[model samples]
Target: MAIARPVRALGLAAIMMWCFFLWTIFRPGAGIKGPGDSLANLERDPNLDPTGEPEGHLVHTSDAYLPDANPSARINATLLALVRNEELEGMLQSMRDLERTWNHKFNYPWTFFNDVPFTEEFKRKTQAVTKAKCNYELIPKEHWEVPSWINDDLYKESVKILEEHDIQYADKISYHQMCRWNSGLFYKHPALQNTQYYWRVEPKVHFFCDVDYDVFRYMHDNNKTYGFTINLYDAPYSVPSLWPETIKFLAQHSEYLHDNNARDWVTDKLRRPSHNDQASGYSTCHFWSNFEIGDMTFWRSQAYEDYFNHLDRAGGFFYERWGDAPVHSIALGLFEDSSRIHWFRDIGYQHIPFFNCPNSPKCHGCTTGRFTDGEAWLNMEDCRPNWFKYVGMG
Candidate 1:
């Protein structure tokens, strides 16, 4: 029985009306919360006696957390970042949103960095909103400047290509400057220079979980290093031969390796097929270096620096548009190995085309036990170069 246009339209309208009624019931656009949350919140309310005491007062519906004090900051962390002077306000606003949401369930401080002075205004406004203890510092001059080994011709040529194509933000000179900063200087910031472990954060990123345990301390105690939020990029079109060059570099510079655990892990991973396990397979290499927590001394170690410098000298920073992904992945491969890299398999994260929620069906354990299934949460499982065992979530 084919329906006439009038009848069909009315039916759709009725269905849509029903949906709208449900939306009103569910309160759509009330922020990230969904109907399930209302029920959950209701269920939890009776458990919390708000007038009881400090602990009673501690209860809240939101998952966001804030720092308690300096010593408390040392216990757990919520390391945040700032690389550009221009984006300070936007970053602060994002922090404010996170602070507004997370209050004290996660009392972790923030660490801010810049290649220039953190203006007093930036500090004042940020503190007003975040309230959490915040530390601001300038990226030392050495850390901001381009390394001398960068090949001017190749670097310029690459930029010219991106610009000729009018690649997204490719023409923005400041972006390039910041990209360069990320490459050579960020990890070298003075405040973080001596710290054994730290988290790399940026303005405007979201924190949507109740994180009580000190992540850095967890790594420090367990002797794991190198955590990240997203997966590394893998576009062979970007640099076809660059991968081989990286392998060669690792082979030659394997001596200065620091973490025997990491080295063994990555070696085994390197031989494994990409997620698909195809014959002409690509490596299941992750390039999500946007957010990372790693040991300062390890990066500053002679061996690691030697490799970084060697690659920097090779002009990859400019030549191939070398991103932090390849740099971190290669370094992890050569230095720490699989056992050393800790993938925070359950941390909620978003980059593009994906939103990573740990407990969801798509997580570290999603695989038929293969890296291919990908991390629904953060996948720290031992990759093909499986040295780092993805310890089950905390």
Candidate 2:
């Protein structure tokens, strides 16, 4: 009887243990909740489906994982790059950084332009790396070729003199073509017509900050016409005739010059154009154009189109090796209010020796540090210290 009683107790204990095990495995509040229950219990997003299912998928709503608005519809913009087949690798590096920093979340489209057709390998490799929509187009030969208006005899003479003086890219005809295309022709490209805004990127450029917000949206909302990262003096030797021509244009078309402009930064105390040397003429301070975000409407406007055409007719792009930086600066100086031009101090950019690094720790992952007091270039006569002063950004 005693043995039987002990056996009975043992059996009851076993039963209780089994029941607990089953409860732990299958009960309503069991070991781990199912996906549906877990999702249902989560804090709901204001945008979440009231029925707790979004498009037949489990809704995993939480403060940490809130529903995200699609950035594409909000941004009327695209990333533009002018690259060659050989520049594919360098461009990919820049693209990868761009994705990591900003574009991955937004999935903005990218348009790559080349004077010649892109190679199959270049296309395949670039598309494989990014999920964003990628388009490649060949620039028309007419757009890239030297215009008939340019005097071939004079251009040859200028190139000879520049080459003798060892000026950078002076001997390369392609460089001049590139400068001219960027200065006036790129906005007219058929592929870019639909976009209201563009962010121009060059090969091997670095994106240092994690840009969480939409830059395009910001521009749209703020009514900003132009954005730039670095401001420096254009090589005076490269654009000696550019400012004088600009002054002449402004004088004749007084209506084009904005009443509120940044001309003081680009011009001298005499209210005359100057160079970095503080000469009686231009200070040559211009926004570096390699990294620019701008409203396309600004470029398509008559003011800019006329300005570019006037400059083109002058033959300085071919003769004096004029660059797009000074050309763009001159246009903005004349057409837009100084207040509309934005300095992207948060962005970190580097092109060889010069860098526009932000002081913000928000860019901790950047490869380079901030431009410091020790930088000799910052104090150089060519750097736009006065622009910094005028803009109250130094």
Candidate 3:
């Protein structure tokens, strides 16, 4: 079709304008020297915004939204921490040195909990030794003292029983109190209020190799709520055969009573094959509560509080040399679903009564000839048949 002269001229003008605008906006800008401009100029020139931070970057991107990206994350556990209390001069210094690598490298904070006050020299010196924040706290009066509810008579009876059996540290009421406090209240510290993960450290506990990744972070990240070393010393005979009472509580109260965490810990033949899961009504009782990394909320749960209170009311803490380890392990077994109590086969652990090593270099040293059978590690299995089997006869 033939176009009118004025219309054709207008159309040609419109095309030219469109081409000019596209060239200016879509095409790359040229340098003052030539038609080709360097990307460096985009970065150097603030107006150009070469980084394009608003858009995004390939690496080292902003983590403003990440929970662990800043200080607040330490509480929710996007970033987590571990702290140790060092007592006495000898084991204290050695363990402190071992901690330097883990603390300095990870910048994890360490809080030294002691019943006796830390001296001026110790504080100044320890601060200098660790780049991490070092806090010294005197064990509170509430933590150290035996509550009035504790029958002094029962306490002495427990001590006498231990003496007769020759169990070391049985006579030390302070040690018993320490165990109770560690399991019951250590995380209640104001400084740790925000922390979701914690590693309890005694004075001489040592980490041998160079640990690059933050263990607290790993536990928190992977949902490996509880980690520990040194299994054994979890004899049910050690606690009151309170299974009748405890099992009744579980079946009536919690749905996850015999969950995987409970099953694996109490029923696994690898850990406690002969444990009586059925007697405990398939309860999860085979757990070692000490040397553990765990979910803080797990302890804060109503189940734990009730269990601790019930055990306390029963006077188990005073009536027996009730170590917090067994108590804590039992609680984890009973209360948490199998997904919660995690076994760290790689952690090296040692104690009296011995356990089948999951991944301890001390595996060759599992020579603890005394409590050789899996019964050495107490659980529901010791009381019930076919307890260690994952699947029940049901």
Candidate 4:
């Protein structure tokens, strides 16, 4: 009787082991699904490619314009550029490079904004480059001009001080107007009312890599609020009161700050020497505004509007020459989660002296390692380390 009982126990244990092995092989995420698997199972599988492309498919430069490479769904987006009528040639060069590298296949529409009416020649020449629809809109006078509340005497004195310090564009009132307009009024324009996402394109900038995927769709599906290609320090002399005014706003409305906010990156609190030392306000690190891909809804939100109004009331835009770069950076750093702010490391972009040349196979007409190995000025202003450290990737 004892021997027969032991034999039955051994058989039962073997059967149980075999069942567990089968379960492991056929688990939900094991990549071994039957032909009869449900679509829900396929959607839930993380091992599958998000782009729906077959595994191991190679993407060449010519593949950028392939009809089959287009995304299955597209996000509501546009290529937005605020340009002058005189920059026609430079704008054309930028448009061609972007269309060649990425936009030809998807054919997203372009929206151009000018403080004044666009010239017929400028409109015709730009429209001739691509298959996408083109829009030209004039900036409203109220949106482009200095606010009524700005004290003229204070503003003039500030400009004089900036000039004495040899700050760039200090004596130009139009530059201040442009910075203020870009910071608070661009998204409010009538032309961009229906658009949810915008990729800002500036004249004379270059796109170096072949982008095989839809960036707007990527931003939407991935829940990214802001994307940038370059990071650098802002000129401190240009924004003397920006950080202080930002602090005052934060104090008044503490609830607006995100729980996973990148305050440390902007404040440089983590790298401070001691607790007793005064906290370093805004390390002057900012994302260069020239190459920005962002969701317009964030800028249109109440938090951002209130923040902008506070800064505008403080009169830094005209009083101290506050660039749009630092204003946007400070807002994102305080109000949004750091993870939602993306760095497009694969995109190769250049705006004159600065370059973001990623070491990728898809790039053309640019060399890698220029940010680190090529220029002394770029190295001094590089803010990637601070950003990387904040994100726990350094």
Candidate 5:
């Protein structure tokens, strides 16, 4: 009886130890409760299913994974679009393509701006296309209107000359306003006040690849200031005075230039002999701004503001068809580090008349090697080679 009592006690102890071991392994938040195991951490983990569902099970929820929930996990960015009410169909098409390619997974908010109020139909259709929140904002009049400092007669004469030369949108005042606003004023909008990064989406553009990762987070983590897919030479005739004006600005604010600037990519200084004075001229190479993923703080800086004011006061936006593409490119090439400006070669993008298709497994419905033609002239005009050489990636 004594031996049996001792055996029974030993058996009870063994059972209790076994139960403790099971609790350590299978209790709620047991082995997983360590670094990066908090509820917030699990919610922010892109690889994990936050709903706690079984693997391969789909869970539908109306609530988006708001970046505000865990600010450290995501970037303060938005997909920004400047559109008019009349172009609702084109906007919807762009929304559909982007959603299908990328945004559907991320659910980043869409912020739309217009000089006028967005129509109910425009709002409804755009919101219907995505589960993300949609914000509609009217561009303030002061931001869109022609500055009073501009000479009316001089502007009119310049437009007539550009029209005579068959320049695109030369006679349209609205185009001029758009160019000016996009160049300097877009970042000033109250709607974008809270946003640090923006991916500019234009109407009727194409997104041809599955962007499985978070682009905004990539930009933030990689220290990238500006990202672009297409690079092209700007029309030299359109901005006759832009280069000269940029030279003057550089001379005045030489301190603003970054030590490792990409100025050589935009000029022939490195290509020509050191003694050549004419090599300092602008190459007219620029990033196509129709599709831009940029850090807004770069535009909001005092240096950029001063540069924009200098150009704005020069009246080139109206007197000449000075595009925002060149303006933005020039600023980034001079002020930001070359390494910080990223060429998004993995993304397959297309704006009308051109394609930035990449030879990537993620891309679909596009032919690779379509970025440039075989003609030597076309290839020389392409800024990609120069950019590649500048970045030492070619």
Candidate 6:
């Protein structure tokens, strides 16, 4: 009888253990939702007040979740690059980064233009890395050559003086040709004629964030005409006489100025719009052209075409080595409303000695921390800080 009692007690203990195991496996909100429930239960949460709200917050319900809009319904845009055969490797690195970060999802086509034909190796290597369609086209000679109107003697003298001063790319006539092409001729390229928007990429530029959304879609949806990452002042030595000429053109064409233009951002402390001063001068600050995503329509507009024609006739491109940076800046400041211009805050970009690194905590790929902070170059060139203030975004 005593042995039976002990055996029965042992069996009961085993049964109890088995029941507990089954309970753990199938119990309602037992192991699965305990931790999560504690977080979601406002009444039980320590952060909540007596009203079961998180301190000062009220109870609210959100609308039904919505799926993302079809990304394929994006704007007609292409990623455009102008490069030489020697720059193939550097361009490929940028292409790969862009692909992995954003274009892989969007599959936007890439159009590359070069003065010389792309070598077989350049085409094959670049095509292998990307799934999107790629087109390589040669630039027409007329577009890449010095205009016949420019006086050779004056151009040579100017280049000699700039080279003596050790100015950047001063001795290279090809560099000046490149600036001129970018200023007015690039949008006219037959390969780019079909697209309404272009995101310009240069050799060795870095994109250091996962661009989850379609930038082109944002531009199209918001009606943003121009987008830039870095804004800085041009070296005064590079364009001493350029701004005075711009002032001259603006005075002659006062009808073209927008109602709410970014005039204060471009002009010196001396501009008076009433009399339209010819000597108002420039602040020399320009949005760096190397990293631009803009509507091609903006550049192709009559206002921009007329502006380019006026500057071209002035012969500053060859005579003074005028860069396209200030030319585009001053034109956009006058012709477009400030609201049409956009600063892409999420894009992390680098073009030697300067970067527009994103400050968002969500940014994981950025090597530089913030656009305006910890960089010595911004202080050395005082345009970026002023750009923030001019745009009312400080």
Candidate 1, position 113, lDDT: 78
- Most accurate candidate by lDDT: 4
- Each prediction's TM-score against the native? 0.63, 0.77, 0.62, 0.79, 0.78, 0.77
Error of 1 at 324 (Å): 1.2
Candidate 1 residue lDDT tens string, 1-394? 8999999999999999999988877673232222232221222211111111111112232233334333343543346575566777667655754454444445456778776787888877777775557888876676656667666666677777756544455444455556656655666665664456666656655554434355665666666667664544344333333455656676887565554433332222333444323212335455366667776666777766776666666664555555666566657665665455655644555433333344433222221222223341124422211222321111
Q: Among all windows of ten consecutive residues in candidate 5, which has the lowest summed lDDT?
A: 45-54
How many clashing pairs per prediction, in order?
Answer: 35, 8, 13, 0, 0, 0
Look at candidate 2 and give me any clashing residue pairs: 273-281, 273-282, 274-281, 274-282, 274-283, 275-282, 275-283, 276-283
TM-score of 3: 0.62
Residue 84, candidate 4: C-alpha displacement in angstroms: 0.4
Of candidates 3 and 2, the better by lDDT: 2
Q: Provide the RMSD of all predictions against the true structure, rounded to 1 decimal.
A: 17.3, 23.8, 21.3, 11.8, 18.7, 21.9
Among all windows of 10 consecutive residues in model 4, the one with the lowest summed lDDT is: 45-54
TM-score order of candidates, top first: 4, 5, 2, 6, 1, 3
TM-score of 1: 0.63
Clash-forming residue pairs, model 4 = none
True-structure Cα RMSD, model 3? 21.3
Cα lDDT tens digits, model 4, 156-223, are 89889999868799879889999998899999998888889999999999999888777887787778
CA lDDT, every model vs. true structure: 0.52, 0.72, 0.51, 0.77, 0.77, 0.73
Instruction: For residues 1-394, write the lDDT of model 5, one tens digit per residue.
Output: 2669889999999999999999888865443312332223322112111111112222232234543344333457899999999999998888999999888777888999999989899989999999888999999999999999999999999998777767798878899999999999998988788889999999999888777667787777678799988778766667768878999999999999998887766773332223123223777778999999999989999889999999999999999899999999999989988878877766778887766775656777865443233344233445665565555321
Error of 4 at 254 (Å): 0.2
Give me the overall lDDT of model 3. 0.51
- Residue 262: error of model 3 in Å? 1.6
